[model samples]
Structures are given as structure tokens and as C-alpha cells.
Target: MTNDAVLHTEGLTRRFGGLVANNNIAIQIHRGQLHAVLGPNGAGKSTMINLLSGDLRPSTGHIFFDGQDISGFSADRRSRMGIGRSYQKTNIFPTFTVFENCRLAAQSREPHPARIFSNALSYRTVCEAAERAIELAGLAHRAQRHANTLSHGEQRQLEVAMVLATSPNVLLLDEPLAGMGAEESARMVELLQRITPDHGILLVEHDMDAVFAVAKVVTVMVNGEVLESGSPEQIRGSAQVQVAYLGAEDEHHG
Candidate 1:
């Protein structure tokens, strides 16, 4: 493992019965870089994330984080090791206030989350971390509002804040911009761009415009395989990428 690499996979494969969701995949995510995994539906994007986060076990291969093998670790263990993920769906507590949700996530990272109940309302560190996360997600104004009361875009931002509360080194964002209006998507893009300088982000998104705008490196996956990996400009111009994934729409947008 190199010092710069935050996450590395070697020959990663996952099979469900006779179907192969991911096949012989190998990739490297460097520290403080925004990387994108681009592919059409059924390209094994979600499956790969499941494997990396230990939500699903790989049939074969190894996963390394910070130079340590983590193939056998659980998702919670991974999070504790500074690997955080935001789901495609909003995963915040609907009944909890935005600040409460963030506080819970931050507390989970502490040595004793149960103790948080004693003085959660007044705990300085927890309150401060929650405040920072809410602010980072642009939800500081809604801190006292119930999570379910927020707009869909705000809900998504809350989910990102929940992940941020964990103080992760690598953030695995699964479709952060999905289901948003143009304005909301633009806001998310701006927020994401601001955060990328501080965290290593691996984004899986269908929005070509957002992907190209934020990614320093883009890896194209097709039919459960990585077809090519390159800079955004290289990916835009690659004939293989065009044929396998980009197609005419991607070209026109590029």
C-alpha cells in the first residue's frame, strides 16, 4: 500500500448464485481526491460499495484501508476506522431533529454512545460536532426541525451531515444528487465541491454533469467490470468509454 492511497482493492469479485455482480475489480482511491465510479444501471456500482463497506462479503479478493486489510471487517467497524457512507436513500431518523440526528451519529463514534443520553443536550463536544455537521450540510437553519419536515434536498443533505458527524477520512457517497430539482442538485454540487478538499470522496452518481464537474478521476464500469479509468477529460474522449458507457448523451454533454 502506498502512503497516498486511502482505499485499495485487488481482484475484488462478488457472485450471487450464477450471476457475477463484480468481476476481478481492482481500484485505488487516493487521499483528499474526489473519485467517481460511472456506469449505467446494473454495472455493479452499488454491489461494489456493499463489498467495500462490508455490508456484503466478496466472493474473492482483498480490501485494504490505510494499509490494513479490512476484508473481514463489518460496516460499523469500517465507519469507526474513518470510512463513512451516505446511502442512496435518506437514512436519517425521521422523528429526530436535524441536530439530534447528527448528535446520534457523532455519539456513535465516541467510546460510549450510551452515556450520551445523560447530558446529550448540554454535551459540548457532541453539540459542537453536530452543529458543524449541520452547518456543513447547509442545514444550520433547520437544526431544530424534525428531519422529516425538511424538503427532500434538505433530507439528503442531512444524510450527508450524519456521515460527516463520524469524522471520516474516506466518504462513500451513493448518488448524493439523486431525486433533486435542478436548484437542489446545484446546491449539492457546490456543497460537495467544498467538502472534497477536506475528505477523500468516492462518488457513485448517474448525473454526468455533476460527475465531470467534481471528479478528478473517473472510473467507468460496465457489465460488472471496469472498462477504463482516467481523468475526466480522458474519460470524455476515450472511444472505449463512449462505446461501453458514455454513449451519445455523454458526448453531447461533454
Candidate 2:
């Protein structure tokens, strides 16, 4: 177990009857670094996230988070234990203000989340976490606006803000740049850059440009197995990655 790594997995495997979604996967994520996972559809990217987030239990493997073995933990337990994630589909309270949404997320991690009778602001810790998350996610200026009023990009940022409010050490972001314009993509990338110093960001994205721009390490998967994992430059020049993934795209375009 490396003290520096916030998250690590050994032989992380998940099987569904005859199908093996994730196979003997070993990976490590250290804080202050962004790790990107790239793969085509059916390459087990989603399974990896599910396993790490405790949304799906591994069939055969071990998961360690911050030096604790948490493979048996549940999704909510993992969230409370500082594993945060944003889904591919937008998940926000459309009618709520940005601050309210963040405050709700912050409250979820609190020991007194069920204290409904008390004033929400009285939970100073939750309030502070929410405010800090809003600032970090670049939604401070829009804190008072309803969530549905924000653009698609800002909504994406809000998703991250909500996760940050939980005070998570690991962030599993799935396709954050899925539906965004050039400016929005740039802003999200910048936000990721600013936040990398705090958490071990596990990004599963199809956007190669974004992956290369922000990722310190890259892992490529094929057919539910890792074909290669290395620095961004090495991944870019790898013949295996080219043939299994990038080259396929290039040839299709050609």
C-alpha cells in the first residue's frame, strides 16, 4: 500500500454470469494528480467506476481507499468516506438554487443530516463546505440562480461542486465534457486544472484532447482489459493504443 496514493485496487475483477466486465484490474490514484481512463464502448470503463464507487461489488478483487480496504463498502458509505463522483447524465435539482443544491450535498456527509428541525444554516460545517465547494466549482457568481437556468456547461460544473461539497478525496467524473461548446469545454478543463491539487481525479472521458491536456497519467482499455497504462506522451505514441483505439478512429476517418 503506497501512502501517497489515495486510492488503489488489486485484481479488481467483476463478472456478470459469463461476461467479465472488469478483469484483474490493478490501478492506483494519488492525490494532486489527475488520472484519465480512456476506452471505447464495452471496454469496461463504466464497470471500473462502478466498482470504485461501490455501486457494484467486485466479484474477485480488493479496493483500498486512503489505505483502508473498502471493497465491501456500499455506495453511500463510500460517498461518506470521501469518494465522490459525477454521472454522465446531469444530476441536479433543477428547481433549487445553486447554493441550495450544494448545501444539500454538503449536508449528506454531515453526521447530523437528519436534523431537519434545525435551521440549515445552523449547521455551520455544512454551510462552510457548500460555500467552499461553490467557489471552487466556479459557481459562486451564480449561487443564487436556479439550477435549470444555468447552461449545460455550468450544470456540469455544478455536478462537480456538489461532489466537492461532500469533501471527497477521490473524484470519479464520467464524460464531463459530453455536451459543451468550445468555451465550456475550455472552462471545465481549467476548473479541472485548478482542482487537481486537492483530489485524485479519476476521469473517464472520450475526449482525447481533454484527456491529453489535463491527465498526468493515462490508461487505455480494450475488451474489458487494460492494453496500456503510462504517461500521456507514452500513451499517445503507443502502437497498441493506436491499433486498438486511436488507429481505428483514424482509419475510419481516412
CA shift of 122, model 2, Å: 3.0
Q: How accurate is candidate 1 locally (lDDT)?
A: 0.88
- TM agreement with the true structure for every prediction: 0.93, 0.92
Model 2: per-residue Cα lDDT over 6-64, one tens digit each:
99999999999999999999988999999999999999998999899998999999999
Candidate 2 runs further than 4 Å off:
1-4, 114-116
RMSD of each candidate relative to the true structure:
2.1, 1.9
CA lDDT, candidate 2, residue 67? 85
Residues 1-254 of candidate 1: C-alpha lDDT, one tens digit per residue:
35547898989999999999999999888777899999988999999988988889999999999889899999989989999999887888999999999999988766464674576666678778889998987888999999999999889888889988888889899998887778878887888888888788889999989999999999999989999999999999999988877785656678
Off by over 4 Å in 1: 1-3, 111-117, 248-254
Return the clash pairs for model 1, or none.
none
lDDT of each: 0.88, 0.90
Each candidate's clash count: 0, 0
- Looking at model 1, report the run of 10 residues with the lowest lDDT sum: 111-120
